[model samples]
Target: MRGGFCSGGLLLLLLIAPAGAAGTERADRLAFEVPPGMAPAAVAGDETFQGGFTCRSDAGENSAGTTACRSWISPVLPLFVFRLAWHVDSVTAERVVTGIWIGRDGASEPLQEMSGLELRMAVPIENAGFELIDMDFDGHLDMRIVAGGTAGPNVLYRNWLWSVDEERFVDSAALDEIVSPEFDPETREIVSRWRSSAAEGGVDVYAWNDGVPVIVHREVDRFDGPARCIRTFYDRIDEELRETGTGSCG
Candidate 1:
């Protein structure tokens, strides 16, 4: 009688297993399926791997006779896989990213999407489309998307931080607005450099304050004349940036 009872219990559990799994699959599907209008541009082709993510792309010409491409990548996160999608335009043979989508990995549906982003290089989508880093000194990896860049190697990124409480990525407008930000994980500072011309530029060092960036120091360099240049130093005092000293441009 005990053996028969055990067999009945096992059969009941097996009978309910598929229904439970189906419910979970449906919930996930409703939560993270591809956005409606973007379904037509879904990437359909062979898959490739880039920067630890599986990627795919679909290319075609738009109405303007320019090559338009849609690409997506699946990057594994701590508890989930991050799926990213973007649009690219090839004009004069230069590809530029114009839109982006953030989604869960298993399905190609986007939970968030942005369009009309600043022009950024499109190919090598791993580096240009997205970046995973520890931005807030938190051990968890954060996210960044290429916003724009100069002709030089000065690339700018739109930053997003992973929120432990929220269990999702939250946008960091302060970090995103930094000019040519370079992260120093060791020093835990954000260094930014910008130039208006070949002879005019400045460097700013910032430290995180209450999850925001506050400028701590700066060095300005510009030509005073065709041959003479000046280098000025500034330090933060009482939340103000004050010139500390000046020297010859180095």
Candidate 2:
């Protein structure tokens, strides 16, 4: 599944716009093809659980010359939450989601659902923040490390932490402290952190202990008039990490 965090403006649109409308109008619709031999009921019903997590079809439509679907699951507290958004071609029936998955516990594996498929990935440490990136250059998908968090006003920092791939979030730190100082993928560290003055945004880092991923979160607030900034962290507990290391030592 190809996906990433929603930008502040987009996030607002998602929250306020009628379900499935923004997705059909703004997102490029894809041809959603069901695997051969799979039952039509597979994508039916309001919700289904794949690999121990729940997947739900939050909304759907066929009125606007497009078909759309959305799904979400709360895998962990303050980190490791999964969300999926798909816009399907009205004629071809192809689908794609702007997927979002976070593991608040380092030990828990990441849960994901995209393109009407689901899978699990090993994540050794609880993430501060993560965003979907086309890392392999396959145009398939990859995850980018943004920051880490365990708890506290997490929604405010979601965009800053999980929205950018390399430097987009880092470049805007002065505008929001919830931004991690830096992201070094080779070193697996998100360093040099500041805090938010607004009540809604912050950052946090988490790691595993005794095979359990621990969570830490930081928050910030930027009162840009009526426009408020918020960040959040979520962790997954079902998946476990296999190695030990520190992310963003600073």
On the 0 to 100 scale, the lDDT of residue 242 in model 2 is 28
Steric overlap count per candidate: 2, 60
Q: List per-candidate RMSD values in Å.
A: 18.7, 18.9
What is candidate 2's lDDT per residue for 1-250, written digit by digit as tens?
1111222301111212354766555433322333344221222332221111222233445421211222111111122334333333455443323333333323234333223221121222122123432221111122333233324323222222222233121122321333343333333333334433433333343332442223333322334456543333233335532223212111
lDDT for 79 in candidate 1 is: 22
lDDT of each: 0.54, 0.29
Evaluate residue 231 in candidate 2 and report its C-alpha lDDT on the 0 to 100 scale.
35
TM-score of each: 0.61, 0.21
Show model 2 residue runs off by greater than 4 Å: 1-29, 32-83, 86-130, 133-183, 190-205, 208-250
Cand. 1 Cα-lDDT: 0.54
